[model samples]
Target: MRDDEFLAERFEAHRGQLRAVARRMLGSAAEAEDAVQEAWVRMSRSDTTHVDNLGGWLTTVVGRVCLDMLRSRRSRAEQPLEPEAPVPAAVPDPEQDVLLADSVGSALLVVLDTLTPAERLAFVLHDLFAVPYDGIADVIGKSPAATRQLASRARRRVRGARSADSDHVTPARRRELVDAFLAAAREGDFEGLLDVLDPDVVVRTEAGVTTGASAVAKGAATYSRHMVGVPVPALVDGATGIALLRDGRVERTLAFTFVHDRISVIDITTDRERAARLKITLL
Candidate 1:
């Protein structure tokens, strides 16, 4: 094979692993693909004759690309973008998507989103992918010690956010809070809804993010007036949540994040296709 063709083959060999790293770092399949492609482009333009480990080189390239994307994403006020239009023959496989979601867990992704770009890169590369601190430090432009600290902070935040063992709130308590929220929503009891929500709760939907307990509660009350489905308790992505069923089919899902007995986050999924991919178990 020609030298260029040989290089392409080598890059292809590491594509899957690079894409996996980007997916976790960016939390979006489309963005992950873009980052991997950018890495391939950079590799093609550079001379890797002395590079001993091509896989590690490609990983660092993809990591840098994803870090840049994350920083840019934050500069834009960290708004979640609308779902990309489907590309011909490029639509993600439902099974693969589910597997990826299961591997990382949607709740973990939400928590990761709260991390800074450097902290995220440090945590994801070192903790999730087992990259060395020295290599990860090079990617984020930090010393190995600083990079380790970033990962440590991110680790504590992740554990505090998702690990049931780290938090005082038990699973049963979470279920009770979600049940109360659902009941209040269904009954248009605004004050009851406020009782279960944190003062600074955040609600995220396809439309946009709504913050503050009063604002979220108002929206919930309005939704109840025109609601058409039966909202039942369910474990959404392994987190206590509710699923709205219409005609025996799930129509929407509400995933909750509780902090000290009050719901701090409410992620609402209204897209049927996306909702179908969530690992939900009815309670």
Candidate 2:
């Protein structure tokens, strides 16, 4: 085979892994495809004669592209958090797509959206994908210790949102907390809302990020008073949540992650396309 053909074969072998990494980094399948394509373009232009581990090199390229895309999105305040369209298949294996979707559920995506660009990359690469901290530091331009810290903070946030302690939180328990939050919001009870929200709770929306119970409560109060449709209780990506329907279609989705009976994170999306992408079941 010619040299170019050899390079193409190697690139194809790692395409699926690169696409998966991109998808997790960017919440949109379309964007993930773009990132992977961009990586290929860069590799095609560079001289890879000295590269021993092509997979690692490609992963680094994809990560850098994803990091740039995420930072650019953050710079533009109007970008929506969730994106429409099914994530393109990394390979032709249908089973792989199913497994990937099942693994990266909506609840996880919601929580990830709250992380900063550097933190998200660090956590996704190191924690989820098992990339070494040193490897991740090179991608984000941070010291190994700092990169580890970013992943550590992200891990704490993810754990707090989705705790593994099976004893305390049941489906019914989660529903009760969500209902309580709605009740407080509707009644414009700021203190009541705070009572149920974790002290360092995070509320993320298209508008921006709000941290702390007090600030989240203040915004929740306003949202409650202006709510148009009655919210139906539901499970969003296997987590307790709610959906507002209009004309028999989901107009809004509110996904929550709890820690020890208090809400640690709340992800609210009013964008129609984004809400449709979530696995929602009205109760």
Q: How many pairs of residues collide in model 2?
A: 0
Model 2 lowest lDDT segment of ten = 103-112
Candidate 2: segments with Cα more than 4 A from true spot = 78-103, 164-200, 205-258, 266-283
Provide the overall lDDT of each model, using Cα atoms, as 2-decimal numbers: 0.79, 0.80
lDDT of 2 by residue, 1-283 (tens): 9988988898999998898788888877788889999999999999988999888899999999998998788666434445554445545577766654554554245434777778889987875567898899999999999999878767667666445355266778889999999899999999999989987687777766676688889998998888888789888877789998888888999988777778888888878998899899988
lDDT of 1 at 11: 92
Model 1 residue 177 CA deviation (Å) reads: 15
Question: Residue 231 in candidate 1 has what lDDT?
Answer: 88
At residue 225, candidate 1 shows an lDDT of: 89
Evaluate model 1: give its TM-score. 0.55
Q: What TM-scores do the predictions have?
A: 0.55, 0.60
Error of 1 at 110 (Å): 4.0
Alpha-carbon RMSD to native, per candidate? 10.6, 7.4
